[model samples]
Target: MPKNSYKIPSSLNRSFLDHEVALSGGGFQAKPLPMKVLLFWSGSILTLFWVASSTFVAQAAWWLIALVVIWWLITTAFLGQYSKTKEMKFASVPALLAYVPAAARRVLTRTSTNPSSFYSVVGIDNISATGLIKYSDGTLGQGYLVVGSASILLFEEDRKAILNRVDSFWRKVDTSCEYTFVTTKEPQRVYHQIANLERRNLALEVRDPELKELMDEQYDILNDYVGKQFASIHQYLLLKGDNLESLRRAHSVLQAEVENSSLMIKGCTMLNGDEVTDMLTVLYKGKSS
Candidate 1:
């Protein structure tokens, strides 16, 4: 007999994960639901009551049950959309509570459904966007963003390595004197852009309004400071001229003040903001620039 070759069919792809959209606490980190007798029997009893509550003829009762089933399905499905995406925390507890709910409200403002493909958190300022990152086991990761899932797969996973790379670029400058800094203004333009982007594209819908705004605002503040700090450094360098050691000392003291002030603002962090402010005062007494 001639040689016969048989091919095995591949199974359909059905993973617990939704690769296209990976939000914080990815791939069903949802708490295991409490499936007690109350939930099970309550639903069952309600279902039975809903069916038997009707006193029409058998055929008519069947029609009524069908109608009820359809209605229940619609309501549950619609509500399910809202509950799909969970929120994350920011700096303050109040901010966390306020913004996340806002993000959800923003989502509800337009469509009844959540974003189809991706997940996003709109910061308070709106300019700083953290692209969704993933850890190896599919957790919400922190690092540089990878554009696509294919890119995520191809680039090779190095979460720790990339995070360290980000850490290396860190520059924390301290200032001894009070500075003219712009107070934070919410990014109205970016806010609208995000809304417009979500609206124009049916693929990605925003989930929480308040949370998005908080993120957007924080981004604006960070962005505004970034340039000012660099300029301040440049100005100091220019004014110092030949005295590099004095400049270094001034910078160090200023840095310490900053570290202190940061602690104050953060309250529980490494240094208090008041401590930073005090150091800055001392440095100011010693140097002019």
Candidate 2:
């Protein structure tokens, strides 16, 4: 966690065995220009020719032709230079020719119908009491809240030890099962404390005047801080397997790793039904209800 300390070398690496057959049976090159860039440039070239031909037929002004040519050169040159970067390799074409037209067609041909429920769309059947989430496809998953890891506050040597333990933990994990780690910032319900305080004040049968004034001041302070509170970062880990038995095995391995092999994890609390629902809402809907 230190700014300039040594990093643990990653144990996860692509195996040549995985790509051996594909490499030998070659079709397209391993890496090429993104499809979106190819499409955009192709469309640009066709549009350029079409405009030029149409101008010739209409006897357009000479300045018009020069302006179009200059614009085309500038755009193509700029894009060509920009596309040299690694990020542009995954660029997508504009939605005007694809998504926008499809959306417009859908609107024009709209029909009244009930929308599908969120659970149906996400393919989640239920979250069990013991923190197992059963999906429509029969997969069982368990979610855990990573409460805290204090590696950032540790000295250099301690941080390195934590990193080594983390690496060992990953290496010892069951590779066949699926695991996902997510980190996100979610807004905390800072208004709840004030609301609860107000409720308690109202429910009191006998309240001292002095105590009441202090409570009112407390409520005012909390109310003022409501919207200014910082969002808390949450880290989650999901372990998934094909069936209950495999899921249990994975969970055992996870517990063992945390207790015996890893010093990087401070706590891992399993999520119940409500907690699972809240986590899902934060992940997909971008806010927790």
Candidate 3:
């Protein structure tokens, strides 16, 4: 394989669909405020100020009171409609009253769990793999591997060096291997067990106290793992056409290298391709039926 061998198809060149996947070198575009929204907010603030001023003066007119009442009703209606339409949860009266204390407690207990680095998938450029990864802690040790489009790109802080390495690595890869040994047995069993558990009405079931607690704990663990695996598969599925195939190959390579201490990079986790693929297949089958 040469640096110029792998070309990104035109179909896979669209912006990422996932909110979690950030694009490299792209900044957020500032959308202009609509004229109607601006006017509504301005009128709201003016009306609120008028109501306050009238209260202070102790000469509130009946007309002024009526206007304030109308404004309040309109504001409430607008907020209610917006929340309902957007499926947003508005704070209840009790929740609003308790918000201050809840917020304070949250601040006190907040843990610093942010990742030390951020990585984004940059598609191939007709030659080698390209992507951007930034380290918050600046201890950029070994390069990170991104698996997708049946290809793997080893990326480091140094752009030029990583590009060269990607080119060199691809040349040595035996692309002819059909990767015919995809093992879905374990993943299929997990998926079937998950489906069976989901269909069961566990909430109504009676069991021994100790057994119930242990079962609940195990259920939670399995559910969490399945969710993570599904998410990983969904992210890969976002890649269109041939890109998906490339990802499959890349994932296979990375899975083998996961336990290699010298090659494993910090702040990155390689997902199991076989599990993701099997889960996806099962999901598609369920959806179709």
* lDDT of each residue in 1-289, candidate 1, tens digit only: 1113545433355233222232236455553422332243356557656655654423466677777667765654443332223211111347556767655445322246664311343211111132222322322211110111112443333433443332332233323222222222222224454555445444535757775676566555545554234332100111121233444554354445444443211112122333333322333233335
Judged by TM-score, which candidate is best? 2
User: Each prediction's TM-score against the native?
Assistant: 0.20, 0.54, 0.23
* Candidate that would win on lDDT: 2
Better of 1 and 2 by TM-score: 2
Using alpha carbons, what is the TM-score of model 2?
0.54
Cα lDDT computed for each candidate against the true fold: 0.35, 0.68, 0.40
Candidate 3: misplaced stretches above 4 Å?
1-161, 178-221, 224-230, 234-289
Candidate 2, residues 25-78, lDDT tens digits: the string is 345654444444555567778888887777573367778887887898677656
Question: Candidate 1 has what TM-score?
Answer: 0.20
Q: Compared with the true structure, what per-residue lDDT tens digits does model 3 show for residues 174-258?
A: 4432222222222212556666665553654666788667667767766766544543322221211223355455545544444
Give lDDT for model 2: 0.68
What's the lDDT for residue 4 in model 3?
Answer: 41
Each candidate's number of clashing pairs is 35, 0, 10
